[model samples]
Target: MGVGLYLHFPFCQQKCNYCDFNSYAGMEHLLPKYLSAIKQELFLYKVHVSVVNSIYIGGGTPSLLAINDITTLFDSIRRNFYVADRAEVTMEVNPGSCTLEKLKVIKMNGVNRLSIGLQSFNNESLKKLGRIHTVEDFIRTYQYARQAGFDNINVDVIYGLPWQTGEEWQDTLAGVVELDPAHISLYSLTIEEGTPFGRELKAGKIKKIDEDLEAEMYENAVKLLKANGYEHYEISNFAKPGKRCLHNQIYWRNEEYVGIGAGATSYMGRVRYTNVKEIPLYIEKVFGNDYATAEKEALKLDKIIGETIMLNLRLLDGFRMDDLTKRFKTNIDQLYGPTIKVLSNQGLLKEEAGMLKLTDHGLMIANQVFQRFV
Candidate 1:
C-alpha cells in the first residue's frame, strides 16, 4: 500500500542511436543544475508519497554520475519521503561506466536492486546497438555488483535486430540463462522516427528482421526463461518467484508513482502527467520552485476504465473484473461483456478462477486486444 517513486538521471556517456528518451551526452556542465532542480521537484510532490515501496533511478545512464552525487540524490529522497524498509531501490547501470567501488557506495547508500544494460552476448550485436561496453565489460560489471553484495539484479537485452540469426539469439538466451540473474528484460527493437535507426531504415540502409522471426524470438525467450524457472510475469520481464520488479509493476498495475527530472511521468489520483522533455526548460521551472508539468490529463469515467483494462491486462495474472466493477461501481458485463465474449471466442482472452486474462495468443497480438477496449 505504499507509493512508488521514479527518478530520471538524464546523463549519458553517449546516446544510443535507437534511443529517443530525453537523455543527453556532453551534458556534464548541467549535472549540478539537474541535481538542484530535481530536489526542488521532489519537494513539490512531497505531500503525495509519505511511504514509498519502490524507488527506481533510471536514465540515459544513471551510472554515469559520480557516486557522491548519486548518494546525494538518494539522500534527498529520504529527506523528503519515507521509503519503506524493504523498498525495491533500484538503479540502472551501464556496463561501460559502473565500477566496483561505485557499486559498493551505491549499495551502502541503500540501493538493493541493480539493473545492468547488457544488450547482447555477441560483440557484433553490441556494436550494432551502439553500446559502448563489450561482453567482457558486462561480465566484469556483473561480477563486481555481486562482490558488492547485490543479490537482486536485472539484465536488459534486445532482440529483432538486423542480421540477428536464430542461432545467435539462442546462444544469447543460453548465456543469459546460465548467469541466472534475478530478473531479465527482453525487448524488441523499435525504430523511432527521428533516431538514427529510423533514418537508416527509411533510406534502405538497414532492414528489420522478419516478422515471423521476431515472433519466434519472443516465443524462444518465453520457453527458455520459463523452463529455467523464471516467471513470465510481464510480456518483456522474467523474474524468479517473488522477485518481479516492484517499481515497474507499479507501472503495469497502473498504481500511483511520482517521477522526478526531465521527461519523467507521474500518475496519481486518476491523473497522469509528464514533465518538460527538454532539460533546460525542466531545470528552469523546477529550480524556480514551479510545477514542471508540461502536459496533464485527468482520467475519468470511460477513460479510467479503458486505461485500467489496457494497463492491468499487461500482467500475466491479470485483473479481476469484479474489482473493476466495484471500484468504478459498474457492472463489467454491462460495459465490456460483448467485447470480452468476442475476444474470448477469437482465442485472445480467457476467464479463469474469476480473473480475466490475455491468452498467450492474446499477448502475441496484444494491440488487437487493446484496440477492442478503446
Candidate 2:
C-alpha cells in the first residue's frame, strides 16, 4: 500500500476554548508564507516517498485558505509526490469559514472528502465551546458542500461539554444522523492543561462532566449510530458501509505515513519524527534548510510489537494473529500469551478464529487494555 499523507494547517479564525492543538488565532497574515514553507518541506521528502494513497489536509481550519492558496497546495503535492489516481483527499472545514465558492474550488482541486467541525447543534453549547459558527452556518455549509459535488462528507461532534445534558447530546446525534453524511466522528471532551477549559477547571470555575455521564453518552452514541446504519469501526468513529476514513485506518493499522506542516508527525522506516511546533520557526527552518524536524525516535523490535498491538486494537474487527506473527517473524503467543489470557479471563479481550479483538466491555476502558501491551 502507498503511504498516507497528512498536511496540517495550523491556523484558526478563533481558537476554541477546549482545544490544545498547535493552532493559533490572528495568524491569517502568515498564510502565504506558511504554505510556501510547506511546499519546500514536501520537496525534501520527494525521494523518500514516491506514492501516496491518501492526502488529509487537517487543521486549525484548512478551509481558511484562499482559493489561490488551495490551488497552490495541490499543485505542490502533485509536483512532489505521485498521489494515487483514486486517492482519498480530505480537507477539514469549519462551518462559518467556508463559502460555496471555496467549496466548489476545493472540489475542483480534487478534494473528495470534507470533514466539517460541527461540535454541537445547540446554539448555547456552541457559544460555550467558543465556536464561531451557529447551527445555521453548519447546515448552510453542508448544503453548499453537497451542491459543490462532494458526496463523501464527515460530520464531527463532541459530547460532555461543561454544561451539556443528555437531551442536548441526543439532539445533536439525531440532527447529524438526519443529515446522513457518509461518516461521523464522536469525540469526548478532554480538558488539556494549557487550554482555557483547563485553566477554568483548575480555578474551580468549571468542572469536568461526571465520568459516568460521559460513559453513558458514549454508549448511547454507539447504540444510536449502529441502529442508524453506521458501523462502529473505530473507538471514536462511525461510517456507513464502505465509507470508513481510509487515512485514519493507516494510523490504526500501524502503517507508514508522511505528515507535513508545523507540529505534524510522521512514521516511516520504523522511525517517528515531528516537525517544529512554532509556525514562524517551522517556516524559517524549512525555507532555510528544507527540513524542520524537531524530534525523532527509532523503535526497537519489542517496542514495535507492543505499539502495533496497541494501534491495531483500535479497529473493531481486530488484527489477524497470523498477520502479526508473519510480520514480526515471531510467535505471538510466546510474547503476549499470559497477558492475553488474563485479559480474556476478565472479559476485556477475546481471541477466536485466529483474530484477537476487544469485547463490547473492553471498548469502554480500552485505554487500560492497551496499557497492558504497551
Best by lDDT: 2
What's model 2's overall lDDT? Answer: 0.94
Candidate lDDT scores, in order, read: 0.90, 0.94
Residues 1-374 of candidate 2 have per-residue lDDT tens digits of: 58999999999999899999989999888888999899998999998998999999998899999999999999999999999999999999999999999999999999999999999999999998999999999999999999999999999999998798898999999999999999999999999998989999999999999999999999999999999999999999999999999999999989899999999999999999999999999999998976799999999877888889988999998988789899889987788878889999999998767779999999999999999998
Q: Give the alpha carbon lDDT tens digit for every residue of 261-314 in model 1.
A: 899999888888999988889999987779899999898767778777888888
Clashes of each: 0, 0
Best by TM-score: 2
lDDT of 1 at 147: 97
Count: clashes, candidate 1: 0
Clashing residue pairs in candidate 2, if any?
none
Cα displacement (Å) at residue 121, model 1: 0.7
